[model samples]
Target: MMSDVLKNCHHRWKTLNQRWSLQTRLLYINMLLVGLMALGISVAYYTLTRYDKKQQSRERLNIAFKIMQDDFQERL
Candidate 1:
């Protein structure tokens, strides 16, 4: 089943190659690759930014808890 699909895809690619010049095909393929790469990079950057924000929030909470503990100790 997979082989049939692959063969069909190959046949279509060959048909396209015959219709379009090689340079045009390569240019389109390159553009697709660059667009995918840009999308990946943007996703990675957003993930990292979210992670950094979470880490900062956790650190701030830890500091607040530590300050409260110090106050309790001083009162005791």
Candidate 2:
């Protein structure tokens, strides 16, 4: 099964290789690499921003809790 898959891929690659020129293949490869890099960067940025938001929310909650504790202590 694995050999069959490899044979199919080789056949498709040969067909595509014959259809496109060397320069066109290089350009296509470059565009694919750049697109992949952009996607990776965007994912990283999204993850970092989400983490920062969570940290900020936690900090705000802690501050509010401190204030409430102080108020309760003063009343008692």
Candidate 3:
């Protein structure tokens, strides 16, 4: 009877260990997904910021061109 009980206990321990390992694996996967999402968002934000800066620079250049043209016309 004691041997039977010991065997059952051992089996239960193994089963519990397997369950815990699976849980850990799932947790790692979830963390990976979150990390990927954060990276993607960061990349998108940076891209948008760069695009906005480029657009502002273009607008400033256009204004400068207009001023230079007006000045040249006045001198002529």
Top candidate when judged by TM-score against the true structure = 2
Residue 20 shift from truth in candidate 3, angstroms = 5.9
Give the lDDT of residue 43 in candidate 2: 100
Q: lDDT by residue for model 1 over 3-39, one digit each (tens)?
A: 9999999999989889999799899999999999999
Clashes of 2: 0
- Each prediction's total of clashing residue pairs, residues at least 3 apart in sequence or on different chains, is 0, 0, 0
Q: Which candidate wins on lDDT? A: 2
- For residue 22, model 1's alpha carbon misses the true position, in angstroms, by 1.7
lDDT by residue (tens digit), candidate 3, 1-76: 9999999999999897777877797898999999999999999999999999999999999999999999999999
Candidate 2 vs candidate 3: which has greater TM-score?
A: 2
Ten contiguous residues minimizing lDDT sum, candidate 2: 13-22
Give the distance in Å from residue 31's predicted Cα in candidate 1 to where it truly belongs. Answer: 1.1
The 10-residue segment of model 1 with minimum total lDDT is: 16-25
Off by over 4 Å in 2: 1-9
After superposition on all CA atoms, what RMSD does each candidate show versus the true structure?
2.8, 2.2, 10.7
TM-score of every candidate relative to the true structure? 0.73, 0.83, 0.69
Cα error of candidate 3 at position 48, Å = 0.9
